[model samples]
Target: MDTPQPKQLSPRRRRALIFASLAVAVIVGTSLYYLHPIGILAPKATAQAASTTLFSKPDTLVSYNFESAQLGWALAVTETRLNQGPFWIFRTVDGAKHWQRQLVGQTSSLFLTLASFQFLDPTHGFVAVGNPISLYRTTDGGMHWLALGLPYADGYAVTFTDPLHGWFLAWPHLWSTSDGGNTWNQLPDPPVDSTPLFLEFDKWNNLVFRSRLEGWLGSNGAGQPHVYSSADGGHSWQRREVPLPSGAVASGTLRTGVQALPGAGVIASVNPSTSPNALFTSFDGGTSWSEVTPLPIGGGTGDLGFQDNLHWWEIYVGALYMSSDGGQTWNHISDELPSAVSSLHILDSQHAWAQMFFAEGSVLAFTADGGLHWTRANAPQPT
Candidate 1:
């Protein structure tokens, strides 16, 4: 029985075998790392609500959305840890008065700079994080989060109309999910110029859908805006050449913003250089476009919020402006606002929220009285 030992190799051959094994390990590890860069372990990551009592506000507020005045969620950086993510979500049931620590990423060494969150209702929502982007979905609010296994390594934004129907953007590639983020299929690319469309990474609102079959996609910071409309839910698209207003000298790369109105309409904002931006509307679901009115070039016209066809809100030069006559005329409303706002969400005629950045820190301002007054939930400095 002792004579059954395995043969040993020469010293040189043993060293060569060892080196070969190490090379294989290196190749496999690198491939896995590329698949999930920056430690974005989404396949098995579990998100749970954090219990640590940090400051009153978050450190760095990245994204936030609310279904109602009372029910809302905010994603921010609270701490500097890997196992318990610095990216934390805070929820407010009684409006923005007091926010509770709702959830935290459990992935080790997870890193991201920008993030976007949208809540379709109080129960269903999605969050997309950038910098080796990943998407997560929660059906029972933020109580539990399941990492969506997106086929692409990078995701710019995500929008969900219902619990099952949603759209994802990985640059020029657009993917649609019908199984509540469980499975996805890539949609055909629009015939429009993909070069400028690919450069719209900062503008997340460019890709929008009103329903399962209706959607609008546009590009900004690209020369002369290129917008497209789809009636069959992005299976096919038609390019819309938006016309500039008369006597307006087009300068700089065109910055465009598009919003899908509920039902059969869409609105677009075209800002040519430093001139006043113009608003356009299409009643036949982006089939035909017409300019409505010109808004004063106070701030940039990138942020446009509409409660309905006629009621719209815009933050211009630290002031709130409203247009009831379908953006035909603008009226200023007295309110305390910042010179710039990162994001604006208008729930109705009265209830609205804005995320503002200050030299002190970022603050989430809420207005219940239609921009007449505001109460800010100040974010503490990042730890």
Candidate 2:
């Protein structure tokens, strides 16, 4: 018998059959893959680089020395003489890389004097200006600052524990504000004989009230720095004497900046004296204090900020020093920076920012590896 001849389907039917078979195979393959999954994609690597870059070069203003405040955000203040007018406030939200100048009407003189600044949050803060304490409040961050008048004009240190409660130390007394700096009430004059020129709040409700209370007062003012503790807010205070180290004398005056470790009941204060760079720590919540070994460059007027309860750092003569053992010992970390630093701030144990003031003006520097290496940030111009 001859080979059976197979009948071919129509061309259209053959094409349709081929397409339908392909569609069926694709559908089955998709369904099976979805139903029973297998490793189809490559795995991503978990090991990351040792150090990550957080900020690049910063553009800083002309003023080498300015104040910085840290709440949820960081803020710096600068002054410039633009056409013989007062310097406007230039602020940066992105860690000082860029800044925006605030326009808050013209003052009698273009010379704006920002004495002190404190922020309860990134948005809410107070800025003190002039001989008479003219307090300004900003609810919408630092974009705009509105005046909140306090009777005391010459305010030194301003602090806010929360949005509702804040304090400012003028020459003779301490002022408290509970209504987000809307109004102020003076606390009974602090227990010290002379006016309390400087003060700081410890986490344990202890006030490191300084000035004539512990140091010298009047024209020939110069005395040993004394620390006072107030358990019941500012109602009462107990004097705590910080013992000087074995060789140093307790003759030097305490500086304005005071930092307290609230969790560890440790307080750090700058003592500018004839002795070695003096620093003090109080373990008993300001009731008692002990002197910490000094840093290399001696302490400057800038404040000391603690990285943690154990590590403390200070800025002096454009260099940074760190103490790992609760201020007992210190190591110089200045060589890691590019320029001489004016102010130093520690956001946490790992992150820190320093404003370097050099002959070429100022530059903002940030370090992610705990001050090991620093990179510049773009600073804002003062309006």
Candidate 3:
């Protein structure tokens, strides 16, 4: 591979914005700005690595999903400067000690995960790549990919209920993929505002659907953000009212992020434009909500992994915190990870994987013994 040289002002400017904050003002989910390349500056230093550094260079890792400590998958986006380049699909069978890179597709977003990507398992995955947008699928793990049968992507977000059922979101445009991601049939778009904008990180990265019959989508363009509820998948949606925080108004710059657990209630967090934010949990879908606890503004809201009302991990600026007994109690983990924590997928009370984000590179961290210890994982190789 050739050394990455700074590309154009367009890609660099966009990339810088994506790494700065997960701030999206768009109502519909499509308000995203893709950033690729190092631009004229080098990588920023924020988080720290283990005594045993995961990678010698600056390649980064993203812990998307995991089956076990021995088998997992992540995204490996290399730091580049010249033109948009191919990113990697990272897979590990024996934890993070060793890693293999499978080149996927050329990207315009340094933060490609925002460009819409997902893997149902080690065998089936989808990635939207290049401009005018295209979707690619990998069935035999990350070994190879085949172009998906779709119309146009222009950057899309995809989610899978299983290896066979899935949904694709590109804001006003939505599609359903029954046989994994091989092919998609366009569906009726969600009822959103006429104006179309991009979101850096509004609430959830994409639409959160607990089941085919139940899901939640966000709209935040006119003034404040609103959560849309769907009883019959994306076929139709209606506004789900939420209890606002002390300083939040029904409409303004207020935004809420929602996550639904398998056996637990739907939990959502609200960040107001002016006042302190609060976390809320709804046992009956999103129709009615109650406040759980007040939240401390952290390093970043990149990764707010909530296992239940009590068990979850969140970051602030750079500090990491964990809660075991829902939100009634809390513990400060550390503030020197490297960058803001983006994604934290906790397997049990003890083991989990996390990804940190910066401008030029991304990083990975994992803990086998709960919050007692953490190990910096691996980065991609300079190909």
Candidate 4:
């Protein structure tokens, strides 16, 4: 038989067909972005990567670190429940106007698993993920990451002073890396007494390194607050006896957190679950701590953020306080915070970011002009 010409649709029919095809494409693209399948979908952290397209905004923030008022990163999960699965590392270069997904973690366990991250600067960063944790290092500001071996399956925190010098803490054991994070060396067992009675090092305690050779580890929760100084790059540690305020007896479980200050000192806040909290300072790099001021407010537990020894801030029980003279005195800034604040970062006396948690969801708050005023930054919004 001879070849026959095919029939063509009319103008109206053609328009309908085109619209139908476009609708289908839109639906498929949205489904893929929203119902992101675990392990199958991973975002490329490139300069040209589209922001807020490949993944969902964080349901809750796990941890966050800001190198400056404009540059920062947050470790958050899409699920409301923390242990459900799928964690993401988001970087905001324009002061939280937009956040780019730098990393994704596939971790869904029956038990709760936590993720911790640290950025030595705006460029070099490290993240510890999964229940039996996996460590990754990014030298180019999360544009790329290389997996690093961990000495232990479970680790609570990671701190890097420089690209070459870093430390990882897995409760009683600590590990160090001198050549970036390519290899790890198990350091001398942490001082027996430095370990907290109930290990929540990832939450209340912190591991901070001031330089390649000097670092401090704060052990708190369910015991007398303890601070240990590691002078030889975490190879050895010594307990820095943190004395209580004069005639201030400990009543409840005291929690302590130490922040390596800007120039030459360390700042610590010893907050108790009960009343009568205290703040301490160390001009000698945590070797000796003297009570700076008896905290005027007391509560369940709070967080401390420092721009330097001279400028510090604290968020406790949904209220904000600032100290102009290095934690000696405080002025209540605002009580309008929704709830608990985590990832409290102070870039300067004026610029800062904090993730505030409430009953419905979490919001990222930014402050300018020394926290006298605050505004909600453009965090990821659920589609």
User: Using lDDT as the measure, which candidate wins?
Assistant: 4
* Candidate 2 local lDDT, 1-383, one digit each (tens): 02221233343533332222111110000100011001112133121111112221122123222224221222222322221123334445455544544432222111122223445455666555433335666666555456667756444346566667766665458777778678887877665443433221111122333321221111111455555555555655655555544465555354322344634554544344564445566666656667666565534323366677777777654456788887777787755553243356677766876654433344556777777777666654432
Candidate 4's TM-score: 0.74
Residues 181-265, candidate 3: write the lDDT tens digits.
7677787888664212353544343477676667776544435455777777678887766677766666565556666765656
Give me the displacement of residue 8 in model 2, in angstroms.
96
State the local distance difference test value for candidate 4: 0.60
lDDT (Cα atoms) of all candidates against the true structure: 0.58, 0.45, 0.56, 0.60
Superposed on all Cα atoms, the candidates' RMSDs to the truth, in angstroms, are 16.3, 26.0, 9.1, 15.3
Model 1 residue 123 CA deviation in Å: 0.5
Ranking by TM-score: 3, 4, 1, 2
TM-score of each: 0.74, 0.63, 0.74, 0.74
Model 4, 261-378: lDDT tens per residue?
7887886667666545566788885667777763467533366777877887887755778888876678888765544434467887678877654333445678887766667765
As a whole number from 0 to 100, the lDDT of residue 22 in candidate 4 is 14
| Candidate 4 Cα deviation (angstroms), residue 229 | 1.5
Residue 91 in candidate 1, Cα distance off native in Å: 1.4
State the weakest 10-residue window (summed lDDT) of model 4.
22-31
Locate the minimum summed-lDDT window of 10 residues in model 3.
Answer: 39-48
